[model samples]
Target: MRLKDKVIIVTGSTTGIGKAIAKAAISEGAKVLVHGLEEDLGLQAIQELGEENTVLHIEDISAAGCPEKLVELAIKTWGKIDAIVNNAAWVVNSDIGTTGKAFLGKVLEVNSIAPFLLIKSALPYLSVSKGVVLNIGSVNAWSGEPNLLAYSISKGALMTMTRNLGDVLPRTHSVRVNQINPGWVLTERERQHKKQDGLSENWYEEIPAMYAPSGRILWPSEIAAAAVYWLADESGPISGQVVDLEQHPLMGRNAPKDPSTIHGKP
Candidate 1:
């Protein structure tokens, strides 16, 4: 077990990539803190993973004092925190020009600021365990996501935060910080987008071949594998790096060369 006896906190664990990461962590013999705003889903995750291995905490990370409380709970329950995956973020789908000020603020608060705050709160506990921090970024950060303007901006901020945190963490405390930027992952929210746009869920199926050169969308499990790896001591030398899960074109500047090699070197 890579994470034997370790305790991890994964926010937004009720569903999507967050759910997959939480389950994977549990499988690797780690005690997982399942966090989210949904009480029922949190309980469901607890039940699915078994009460002995998982604990459910219902709280909005965007809320003030919430990050500290969460870290406190993890310490109180398990006596230590080995890793933290900042997987909580969301947007209602609006471009910069169209998005309201409140919407933009909300996006940054939940997607960007909250992650930073959580890291700060968990630093002490993480330092004791020489733990790592895995923040969830997105392909939208670099791509021209006209529809997700605020979200993109927030993710962009997250990348910068990941780097800055990594740089300072090692010098100050032994904690390491990094991020995983996943490409067009088909989460429930992403599926809703396809349904709303009146398109096939597999419309982007050829994207990996046509655009990504990988030939398919990134599965939640694949991303979860990377997260689990990063949580272990093996990822110590990989701090401050932004692991892009997007299938970058295998050809010229931005063109696909081969679909089978989408997971190849960038």
Candidate 2:
């Protein structure tokens, strides 16, 4: 087991990519603190992962002091901390015209500020264990689709934090930080989001090839697999990387040409 005896805290892990990461860590013999906003979901995760291997933490991360509380619980229960996966996020649609100060602030609080607080609170323990921090970011962090203005800004800030911490922390504390920016993952949350936008129930089957180059979007498990590498000792002292997990090249690539243009349609 690559992560044998490690103690990991994964926030927003009741569902989607976060849930998958918690399961992966536990599968590798790590004990996990599975966090989520809903008590029922957290309890479900604890049941699924087994009580001996997991602890359920229910909290709204945006609330003050919640990040520190989570870190304290992990230490109190397990005696030490080995890793943290900052996976919780609050995503909402907001174009320039629709975005307001309060809306933007809320997004930043949950998606950006909470992660920083958690890292700060966990720093002392991380230093002692020489642990790792894996931040779950998004491809939308680059510039984002116009509709996701606030969300994009928050994620972009998180990417910056990941790089900044990754560089400085390892030098003195031996703690490593890294981030992964995933593109077009298909989770239950995504399904609902698309459905709200008027997509049909079977929308996944109808995604254009231009958007889903591999005939499908990414799965939560795929992201989990990559996370294990960064979280485990096998990775060997690497940090300060922002990996874009996407099929298309994220930079210096032309947009896909229209098929009709090739056929010379008038």
lDDT of each: 0.85, 0.92
| Model 2: per-residue Cα lDDT over 167-264, one tens digit each | 99999889999999999999889999999999899888766656765567899999999999999998898999999988778778654475223223
Q: In lDDT terms, which candidate is top?
A: 2
List per-candidate RMSD values in Å: 4.0, 2.5
CA shift at 163, candidate 2, in angstroms? 0.9
Model 1 pairs whose backbones collide: 208-213, 208-215, 214-262
Best by TM-score: 2
Candidate 1 global CA lDDT score? 0.85
Per-model TM-score, in order, reads 0.90, 0.95
